[model samples]
Target: MAEAEAGREGGESTLTVLVALGANAAIGVLKLIAGLLTGSAAMLAEAAHSAADTATEGLLLTALRRSSRAADRRHPFGYGKERFFWALIAAVSIFVSGAVFAIYEGIRTIVGEEAEQTAVLVAYVVLAISFVLEGISWTQAVRQLRREAAADELSPMEWLRRTDDPTVKTVFFEDSAALIGLLLAFAGVGLHQLTGSALYDGLASLLIGVLLTGVAYVLGRTNKGLLIGRQADPRLVRALRDDLGARPEVDAVVDLLTMMLGTDQVLLCARLDFDDALGAADLERTCVAIDADLRERFPDLAEIFLEPVPRSDPTMRERVLSRYGESTGLGRPTP
Candidate 1:
C-alpha cells in the first residue's frame, strides 16, 4: 500500500511538473514577444521568470530520472541524493537567471537607460493569459499536496514542509512565484499607463525579482538539508521504536536509527535484545520475520538491519552497569 501510494504520488508529481513546464514555456515565449512589442520592463521580467521556470522544470525532470536509477555495487545506497543535488541546482538557477536578470533590467529601466514612454495594450492581455495558465499549474500542485496531507492527517503547510519529494515542492513554489510575478507585472504596467512614468514598471520588476529570490532561498535550503543527509521525521522514529518494542520476541530495543536514502527510501538499523531461549536458528528466523514485517509496514524502509544482541552479552551488560552504577542483567533469565 505504501509503495502504491508512493507510485501514485510520483505519477502526480510528474504530471504536475509537465503541466507547469508546458505552461511556463508557452507563457515565456508569449511574454518575450509581448515585452518586445510593448517595450515594457515588467513584461520583460515576467518573460525572464517564465524562462527560468521552464529551465528548472527540465532540470527537475532530469533529477527524477537520475534519482530513480536502480542501486548497484558502486552505489549501494542508490541515487536518491541526486534529486536533491539537481533540485538545488534548479533553485540556484532561479536566483541567478530569474532574479538577477529581473533586478538588473529593473535597475536599468529605473535609471532611464531603457525607458519606453509608450505601453502597449497587448502586454495586459498576455499578463492575463499567463495568470490563468499559472493558476492552473498552481492548482494542480496544491491539490496533490492537499491529497497527500489529508492521507497523513496533516495540514497543508505542515505537509508541504515535511514532504520529502522536492519535485512537487519546487513546482508548488515556482507556480506560486509565477502568480505573484504576474500580479506585479500587471500592477507595474497599469501604473505606468496611468501615471505616464516607466518607473512603476521598473519598480514592479524589482519586486518580482525579490519575490523569486525569496522562493529560491527556501528551495535551496530545503534541498541542501536533504543532500546533507537529513534524518527521517521524529514521529517515524518513535513509531518504529514502539512497533519493534511491542514484539514478543524482542526483550528490549536498545537502539533504532533511521536515515533518509531518498524521497521514498529510508535505511533503518535496529539493535534489539531477543529472548534468551531463542537458538541460533530461531534468531535467524526471527530476524527474517521482523525484517519482512517492517518492510511491509513501511515500504519506504528500503534497507533494514536487525542486530540481535544477546541480553547476557558481558561487554554490553558491563557497559550498561557502568552507566547505571548497578547491574540488572537487563532481562537475562537466571539459571
Candidate 2:
C-alpha cells in the first residue's frame, strides 16, 4: 500500500518538473536567437538565465527519481537524501551560470562603445512574445502553488517556507526568475530604444544578474537546511502531541522528535510514559496498542520508534504519589 502511494507521488512531481523544463527550454532557445540578431545585451542575459534554469530543473528531476529508491542492505533508511543533494546543485547553477555569466556579459557590453540597434522592430517582437510565454509559465507555477497552499491554508510565501516538495520549490523559483527577467529585458530594450544607447541595455542586464544572485543565495541556504535533517514541521509536532495525549494508554507525551525524510514521509521517535501499569504482558500489549493508534492518526508516518517505560524510580514514584494524588506508571491502587 505504501509503495503504491509512493509511486503516485513520484509521478506527480516528475510531471510538474517536466512541464517546467519544456517551457524553459523553448524560451531559452528563442531568446538566444533573438538576442543575437538584434544586438540586445539584455535579451542575451535573459537567454543565459533561462538556459540555466532549464539545467537546474533537469537536475531536480534526476534527484526526485533517485530519492525514491527502496531501502536495502546498503542503506536501511532509503535514499531520500538525494533530493537535498541535487537541490544544492541547482542552487549553485543559478549562481554560476545565471548570475555570474550574465554579470560578465553585461559588463562587457557596458565597457564597449554604445551601439545602435540595426533592427528595433525585431527586438520588440521577440520581447513581446517572450513576455507572453513567461507569463504562461508563471501562471502554471502559481496554480501548482495554490493547490499546495490551500492544503495548509497559507499564502504563497507561507507555503514556500512550509513546503518540502522539491518540484513545487523548483518551479516556483524558475518561474519567478523568468517573470522578473522578462521585466529586466523590457526595461533594457526599452531604454536602449529610447536613448539609442547600448549602455542602458547593459545596465539592465547587470541589475538582473544581481537579482538572480540574491535568489540563488536564498535557495542555497534553504536547500542546505533541508539536507541537514531539519525537523518535519512544528504543526505536525503539535498535532502528534495532542493526539497522543488523547489516547487512554498514553499518560503524557514526554518528548517526540520528528524529521522529514522525504516530502511527506517522516521518522518519529517518542518517549511516552504510560499511566498505571500492571504486568510485563500488559505493558507489551499497551505498546502494540499505542503503535496502532499512531498509524491510524497519521497515514504518512513511515517509521515509528517508541520506548515504553515507567515514569520514575521507587523513591520518585513515592514522591509523585505523595505530591500528586497518585503516582504514574503503576500508581497507588484505587480505594
Candidate 3:
C-alpha cells in the first residue's frame, strides 16, 4: 500500500512538472515577443523569468527520473539525493539566467537614454494570457500540496516546510513568482503610459530580479539541507523510539537516530539495551523480529540498524550526551 501511494505521488509530481514546463515554454516566447515589440524593460525581465522557469522545469524532470533508480552496488542507498543535487542546480539557474539579467536590464534602462515605448497594448494582452496559463500551473501545484498536507494531518505551510520532495514546491513557488511578475509588468506598462518616463518600467524590472533572487535563495537552502542529510520528521522519530522502547526484549532505547534517505524514504539506527536474561540466540532472534516489526510499521524505513549495549555503559552515555545534550531522553527512568 505504501509503495502504491508513493508511486501515485511520484506520478502526480511528474505531471505537475510537465504542465509547468509547457506553460513556461509558451509564456517565454510570448513574453519575449511582447518585450521586443513594446521595448519595455519590465516585459523583457519577465521574458527572462519565464526562460529560467522553463529551464528549471527541465532540470526538475531530470531530478525526478534520476532519483527514482533502484539501489546498486556503487550506491547502496539508491540515487535519491540526485533530486537534491539537480534541484540545487535549478536554483542556481534561476539566479543566473533570470535574476541577473533582470537586474542588469533594470540598471541599464534606468541610466541609459530613455527609449519610447511602442505597441503597449501588445504587452497587456500577452501579460493577461500568461497570467491565465500560469494560474493553471499554480492551481495544479496547490492542489497536490494541499492533498499531501491533508494526508499528513498538517497545514499547507507546515507541510511545505517539512516536505522532502522539492519538485512540487519548486513548481508552486515558480508559478507564484511568475504570476506576480506578470502583475509587475502590467503595472510598469500602465505607469509608463501614464507618465512619459521609463523609470517605472526599470523599477519593475529591478523588483522582479530581487524577487527571483529571494526564491533562488530559499530553494537553494532547502536542497542544501536535504543534501546534508536532514533527519526524519520529529514526530516519526519519537514514534519509532517509543515503539522500540516498548518491546519486551528491549530494556531501553539508549539512543535513536534517523535520517531522510529520499522522498518517502528513511534510514534508522538505534542503540538498545536488552533484558539481561536473554541468551545470545535469543538476542539474535529479537533483533530480527524487531527489524521485521519496524519495517512493517514504517514502510518509509529503507534501512534499519539495531545495536545492543548496556544502559550503564559510560562511553555510550557520554556519546548520547554529546549528541543530544541534556534532552537525551533515552534510557531515562519514568517520571
Candidate 4:
C-alpha cells in the first residue's frame, strides 16, 4: 500500500513537470519572437525566464528518475539524494541562464542608443496568450500542492516549508514567477509606449532579474539543507518517541535520531533501555518483533536501528543531553 501511494504521488509530480515544461517551451518561443519584433527589453528578459524554466523542469525530471533507483552494494542507502543534487543544479541554471542575461540586457537597454518600439500589437497578443498558458501550469502546481498539504493536515505554506519533495515546489515557484514576469513585461511595454522612454522597459527587465535571483537563492538553500540530511518532521519525531516509550519491553527511549533519506523515506535510530529481566534470547526476539511492528506502523521508515542501553548511564545521558539539550527529557521517566 505504501509503495502504491508513493508511485501515485510520483506520477502526479511527473505530470506537473510535464505540463510546466510544455507551457514554458511554447511561451519561450513566443516571447523571443515578440521581443525581437518589438525590440522590448522586458519581453526579452521574460523570454530568458521561460528558457530557464524549461531547463529546470528537465533537470527535475532527471532527478525524479535517478533518485528512485533501488539500493545496491555501491549505495546501500539508495540514490535518494540525487534529487537534491539535481534540484540544486536547476537553481544555479536559473541564475546563470535567466537572471544574469536579464540583468545584462536591462543595463544595455538603459545605457545603449535609443531604439524605437515596433509591432506593439504583436507583443501584446503574445503576452496575453503566454499568461493563459502560464496560468494553466500554475493551476496544476497549486492543485497538487493543496492536495498533498491537505493529506498532511497542514496549511499550504506550512506544507511547502516541511515537504521533502522539491519537484512540485520548484514547479509552483517557477510558474508563479513566470506569471508575474508576464505582468511586468506588459507594464514595461505599456509605459514605454506611453512615455516614449526605454527607462521604464529597462527597469522592468531589471526587476525580473532580481525576481529570478531571489527564487534561485531560495531553492538552492532548500536543496542544501536536504542534501545535508535534515531531520524528519518534528511531529513525526515526537510521535515515534512516544510510541517507543509505551512498549512493555522498553523502559525508556534514551535517544531517538531521525533523518530524511528521500521523499517519503526516513532513517531512524533509537537508543532504548529494555526491561532488565528479559533473557538474552528473549531480548533478541523482542527486538525483532519491535522492528517488524515499527515497519508496519511507519511505512516511511526505510531504515531503522535499535540499540539497547541503560537509561541511567552517565555517558548515554550526557550524549543525549548534549545533542538535544536538557529540555528533551530523554532517558527520563514521565511523572
Which tens-of-lDDT digit does each residue in 243-303 have in candidate 2? 7667776675555678878777788987667666546788788777777877877866778
Candidate 3 residue pairs in clash (backbone atoms < 3 Å): none
State each model's C-alpha RMSD to the native: 4.4, 5.5, 1.1, 1.1
How many pairs collide in each candidate, listed in order? 0, 1, 0, 0
Q: What is the C-alpha lDDT of each candidate?
A: 0.87, 0.78, 0.93, 0.94
Model 3 lowest lDDT segment of ten: 326-335
Model 4 per-residue lDDT tens digits across residues 19-130 = 9999999999999999999999999999999999999999999999999999999999989989989999999999999999999889999998888999999999999999
lDDT for predicted candidate 2 compared with the true structure: 0.78
Q: Which candidate achieves the best lDDT against the true structure? A: 4
Error of 4 at 98 (Å): 0.8
**Model 3 lDDT on a 0 to 1 scale:** 0.93
- Predictions ranked by lDDT, top down? 4, 3, 1, 2
Candidate 3 stretches with Cα past 4 Å from truth are 333-335
How many clashes in candidate 1?
Answer: 0
Clashing pairs in 2: 277-330
Q: Per-residue lDDT for 1-335 in model 3, tens only?
A: 98898899999999999999999999999999999999999999999999999999999999999999999999999998999899999999999999999999899889999999999999999999999999999999999999999999999999999999999989988999999999998998899899988999999999999999999999999999999999999889989988888777888888888888889899999999888899999999999999999999999999999999887989888888888886758866323
Which window of 10 residues has the lowest lDDT sum in candidate 2? 326-335
Off by over 4 Å in 2: 1-9, 309-335
